[model samples]
Target: MPSYLSPGVYPRETDFSFYVKQISTSSAAMVGVAEKGPINKPTLVTSWEQFLKTFGGYINEGYLAYAARAFFDNGGSVLYVCRVAHYADPTDRNTLSGQKAAAKLVSQMDMYLLNGDPDPLPPQEVYDVFAINEGIWANRLEVQIENVGLSGGTFLLSVIYKGETVERFTDVSSDENATDFVELRVNGVSDYITIHDIWEPVGDTGMGTPRGGTYALSGGENGVVDMADSDYIGDPSQHTGLFAFDEVDALNLLMVPGVTTVPVINAGIGYAESRKDLLFIADAPPMLEPLDVVNFRKGQGTYTHAAFNSSYAALYYPWLEISDPVTAQKKNIPPSGAVAGCCARSDQKTHVWWAPAGIDRGRIFNALTVAYKTSRGERDVLYPEGINTIAVFPDTGINIWGQKTLQSQPSAVDRVNVRRLMMYIEEAISESSRFVVFEPNNPQTWRALGRLINPFLQDIKEKGGLYDYAFQCDEETNTPVVIDRNEMMARVFVKPTKTAEFIELNFILSGTGAVFSELIP
Candidate 1:
């Protein structure tokens, strides 16, 4: 309200409409190992080519690149990747110095005294070149420097990887004040390398020109030899590894490819439960028989003490065999990545409440076969224990045959679709109702909230997400006592739509003389 002591005419405007803005339910995140990229940082990649450009190509050490390829090949449009590596010096966690590859360039010119006497100092180092990340892949890179335009102050630098020239900079100077300074031009622009000019210039003459020769970068280590589950499940305070995703706001799915230890899976489930917005996809150990898998799920056999029971996580069985794009050979990998892609695909083709299984939406796009083919009896045994099986049929290829969370109890939320639907509705409504926080605790404000929420729930019900819903926000919920405490309250009850996981058919035989009309009853 504005006060006007003396006014002839006044104009005022007010906004009365409020609606819920739909949030995306398809974006995903992953924590894994890469050949080259910023360590413990969340990097966004939209396509397979962009991933290769940022993080190096395929490697034999980890399954990160393979999983990323499978994700893009299916239907995933956006992904946030966090690359992790073991520390070179575990005691020093403040610097990434000893884990990178670097080289130095020395001055080629000879200096003389004013009396025409030769100086005693030998050639000094001028510029330092380092790989953009910490990995052994940069060891194959070579930098070439050439004098340009008859000026000893400026030069051209060429970066070559595997004997192929990838990047070249022309007329770059060593002077810090120049517009074409090497550090200013190449620090954040070059995709492969970063430069630092460390030479001290003499009076008025930039005489520390680097020698025209090639230098090879060395001392790069991949840092995966001592990698452990603790490295992937890093400290939340430091924001490393899995905790690096804490900075991201709208992640809907999470995966740590090929790092499927029991401790790590348990930590992931706990993290997802705390966030209350995303689902964690878990993978079973590869190459287990049907009975062995059941025992593993039940904490028997080899896995004597390991078990999983959570509605925020789902366990997938049997690795997938896909043709290796780098080596042109078949490779067996975990099923979590492909399953995530199928979920994203389902969310795109239909609503998030729809089941992402069966033949229609659960087809594995990048897999040639499943590592272990399960029969009908095997699937029946696996599904009841809450292990979603990637089964192979004669003509249907490989498809996700079940959609069950790790919850051992039999309930509506034990199914993946119901749990995800509730999460979606809860997240959408809670985010949109923030506007009524400090408003007056009266019927007008309560009705305003109902007006904003009823349409959103009705829309979901129309889209086959709910069977029915009831919303109440009035004096009954926000009583006189609640008003005295400066509080507001509301309650919403909903019946979620369940998926059809089983079908039944009955067959009977009738006599030849029986009447068709009489038999119909």
Candidate 2:
């Protein structure tokens, strides 16, 4: 209330309809190789077209692009893509460094094609330009500079790719202080190439240099030099590889396309466990047999990392055959991306407590077939070991057949939906209950805490997220002795609805024409 100096009437505003915040559960993160994007940077892409515009289309070296396509094709809404590449050489720097080297003024015409090195440094001044990203895709870029008779060292610059002019800059200058200076105009504007250097033409006679025409760029390398485990794990300090996703918020799912190594899998599983809300969707190695997959889950023979299992991780078997958008050829790739998409779609259509598996929710898009079709008995072996199966039906298409987590124990958390529901509830309530901190440690505060959490649990129950739930924050749970230590406690009990993984039907044959009333009874 404001200080009412000689006031007759005053009103106050108070909010009473507070509820739990809706924590996002459909957000997913993936880390892998890309041809042309900022390396080791997590870029948010909401649609397939946006992903294509930012990261380009599919390439043979990495399956991240294909996975992203599958994700969007199956109704996924949010994705954070992290691009990682193995730099083959030290010369593979970003556009800024290359531009600084090119900015060194000199008079030279000693020409070097893109990626063609050993060209002599220009004695005269010229501007050297390079592609904006590090990859072979830069080979398609070319720049054209023309002297348009503008005063004060002004000129016209055009950027071209694959015979099409993409960008045009008019009245640009070599003067660094000018408003339309070439570097200032193009550094953040041009998507294709950056101005690398500015130097004098070798034969310039002061009547203004010739147009200088067009120069095609080369020497761009994909930098995918045989990825190792360390490349995928990445450095947290440098924010490379998987650590690139540290910038993303509310990422509840993690997937690494085309990477199934033991160390990488262990790292991902451990990371999910650390986050407590993230679920790891694991992809099996390509060309492995069903028995091999079972053995892999058992951590036997050449397969490992199964020992690092938790309720946070779930493994899917067999690759998928989908047509390549670029080549239009059928190719087999990992199923982790499509599985992630199905999880997100399930969370969108139903609650996160609902299983993402089964015929209705597990349909994958752009899939032609599974690489290895498993039999009922094979899945019977795989499911108990916490390995989900991707099976192909005669008319129903490919479906995710199992829903168990990688927690190889006989606990309720082994079920995917139950585990996810618990995580969802914990995150939601934990965020909503922060107001209870530092309040009066009396019955009023305890009751208030219960009042805040009970409604959230009740909402979940109403939405079928839980079969039953109980929230306790009373005197018995937060006693006087406990309060004396400046500690408050709340206990939550939940019975999550389990999916019907197995069904049994019994039939008893009776004499023909037996009494219908007796049979009904």
Candidate 3:
């Protein structure tokens, strides 16, 4: 409010327009073991090549690299990769024994007492060199040092991996305060190794520099041995494993690729449901018969009392077969990665309300075949149990054939499209409505909220995401008691657009004299 004294006319500017910012619903996140990278960190990589450069190439121990490659090949454009590894003790990083290989570079200097007697101290360590990440790949790296400059006070450092020079730093000094100190030159910038200067000047002794020699890093380990379910469902407080995704702001889908253990799947479901925004793409074990898959879904047979039922999760069965880039042999891996990519493609090509299954949008790339080619009868058994099938057809190659969520109770949300559509709308609106938090809870504010939200829902309605929607933010919903409680309430009612999973056609043959209009009626 503004006050004016003795003013004939007053001018004021007002803003009457409000809008909801559109949110992206295509980004996805995955958790798995990698060959080498920052462990338990949610690193975003937009392309397969970037993932490889950051996380290293495929390893024989884990299916992470394979799934990541399949994701990008299948049409996923943005992915957040969280690399998990086993540790003997989760609280102490030092217990990550043998994870990081290291070597100590020493400076040999002849020292004597003032009375011309030899000093008893041995050579002093000048620098400690460590691999950039924890993995066996760093064991092959060798560091080379050479004395340089007129005074020979600085050294040239070269890092070689498998006899190929990967990094070189010249005129690097051991002095901690020097502009070209070894730590400053190589710690963050070098891709292969990091250097720590430990050299300290001894009183009246000759200044020491790193001895010129080639030293190979040792004691490196992959740290994936004896991995347990707890490793994948890491401590949420520490933000490791599935919880590492907490660092990501917006994720539409989640996966722990190739890990289909009952405990892990259950953990992932609970986590996704708690987030209320993303869908967890779960995997059935590879090479399971149709009956076995059904039994698994029903908490019977091999699974023996484990079941999954959630609108925030979808399970896909029968692994996909792709030629391994590292082994050059056909391998069967989980389908969640490829399915996530299909969901992303569907969101991009159409609306989130559209089913991601069927031939047009569910075709998987980089996969040669399915582990099990299910028959129509088998699909009938699988689909009803909420296990999505990756069917391989002679004419259509490999495509996702179902879109049911793990939800056992049949309803509109039992389908993946409807569940995801609700997630998208709810997340987008709730996120964009933060501005109305401290505004006055009056008719003007209520109308402002309506003006902000109605068009957004209308846009979704017009785009086929919703059949219809209604929004109310007034005394009926936010009465005096609610306003007095310092709360503003808005009611959003939506009829989500449903997918046509089954289409029926009726044909009639009429006599030549029969009228077409009478037959139609």
Candidate 4:
């Protein structure tokens, strides 16, 4: 029955009980929060048994290993494990869970790419993976997937630091320009990753680079490289070291849209970090020679196989920006027994990437960051902290993709790279391309350094002055010669070894420069 109310308000039936059991029941049962001090972060997986149950279906012999991996990927600081007992029963799921539960989380975690267990006297484990862009190893992320428990294949792992937050760049979805849901992505998250949708994703639309021009690089304000060398090396004259162009840099060309042919996926995953700037990546371009490479931002710098063959030789995109994985299951295990030796995709070099945006920020890279003496003789981290991102290109096969088996290196890097570079020198000489072995073979060097002969390269004295060089691509003779005139910005390199007498290297020397996504790309 409704209450008969006059001008005054009537009593509502919502009276709650607070003191009903005050004496009998204490205050701890109501709110489980601690009184204060250092608080523990809430964990998604509460119990070891529950975690094992949930992941066993998607797991193998590894339960705790995979969970630790996800936690590290999302920037977990302290891990309080409850290791119950010791058990080597790989297939026993219950045994594994009980053992893991007994372990407590490590309160202070230092995140690094290649971190081996701190067992007695283990030399720093090397876990570095690399990316193959254009059949060449370019982006190198030095990291190791420590715990062995995750699916393998081509994957990009991202991480979002717990103490850090960044806005994602995206379009406003509302009809009226409302600033509610911004488009963005970070390093660490629950599981699924989100990417923003953009119109005309690649510059192949009306916004691509123009022909006959070059990619423009934006340098940080107040820096300079020589002018003659600048035009020759595909480098730019900008303050921020970013390449700018009226069109796409030929290196970043995507599939020509509207051609009905499948659009090649360039820039697979783009991440915009807050402590840093935007990070972007393009999938390896196709194997077609005379391939049109497009640079996204500058909308400039168009070239073909001829450019890579002669003029521009030392460029290969290798690393990728991805979330870090805690589990090392089914990942690429280098012959060296190192977890983070190479990328999970092709097994070259694996690393976490950050977009070092401002003066206050920097990025991470592969390789144990030891305090190394720089050329200036000052000690510094091999890679700096606060670094958000970095870009590295390897010189390898530019025609194909895939990992190097026990038999051979990635053909795109080995075969195509060999022939391409040799073709130039072959044209300059009268002989056909042939790898000549003149010296007695030494097994120690090969055993020590493998096929990497660059370390034995003799030093060439630098004569600094304005020099000239040209890429004489004889479409007729099927050869190209990069003529180093008096030797300007680039130099002729030959690495002599016991097995392979002379290996080739053409170093395109340039001042400090950086690679960034073009605002226009």
**Candidate 1: residue 436 lDDT (0-100):** 91
Each model's TM-score? 0.93, 0.87, 0.95, 0.15
Q: What tens-digit string does per-residue lDDT give for candidate 2 at 464-512?
A: 8888988788788878899899999889999888888899997888898
Tell me which residue pairs clash in candidate 1. Answer: none
Residue 57 CA displacement from its true place in model 4, Å: 17
* Residue 391, candidate 3: C-alpha displacement in angstroms: 0.4
Candidate 4 weakest lDDT stretch, 10 residues: 22-31
What's the TM for model 1?
Answer: 0.93
lDDT of 4 at 491: 27
- By summed lDDT, the worst window of 10 consecutive residues in model 3 runs over 199-208
Measured on C-alpha atoms, candidate 4 has an lDDT of 0.19
Candidate lDDT scores, in order, read 0.85, 0.79, 0.85, 0.19
Give the per-residue lDDT of model 3 (tens digit) for 1-521. Answer: 77777858887886767678877787889888888888888999999989988998887777888888888888899999988888677655456533778999877454445785666456667778899888898999999987644354688999999899988898887666689878888989998898886767774222557777898998788888877788788878778888888878789899999998888999999999999899999999887899998887789876776678899999998999888876789989888889989998988899888999999899998888989999999998899999999998889889999999999899989999999888888888888788788988899988888888899989989988889999988889988899999999889999988888788998988998999998786
Off by over 4 Å in 3: 90-94, 108-122, 150-152, 203-206
**lDDT score for residue 509 of model 4:** 47
Q: What is the lDDT of residue 295 in candidate 4?
A: 29
Best by TM-score: 3
Return the lDDT, model 4, position 232. 12
Span of ten consecutive residues with least summed lDDT in model 2: 95-104
Q: Write the per-residue lDDT of candidate 1 for residues 1-521, one digit (tens) a residue.
A: 87889967889875568988798787788888889998889999988898998888888878888888888877887889988887544333573332778999987666655786666466678889999988898999889988743353788889999899999999888778889888988899888899998888875335656778999999888777778787777768778878889999788888888777888888888888989888998888888888887887778877866678889999898989998888789989888888888889999999999998988789889789989999999998999999999999888889999999989889988998988888888888989999999998889899899999999999999999999999999888988998999988899989999988898877868898988798787
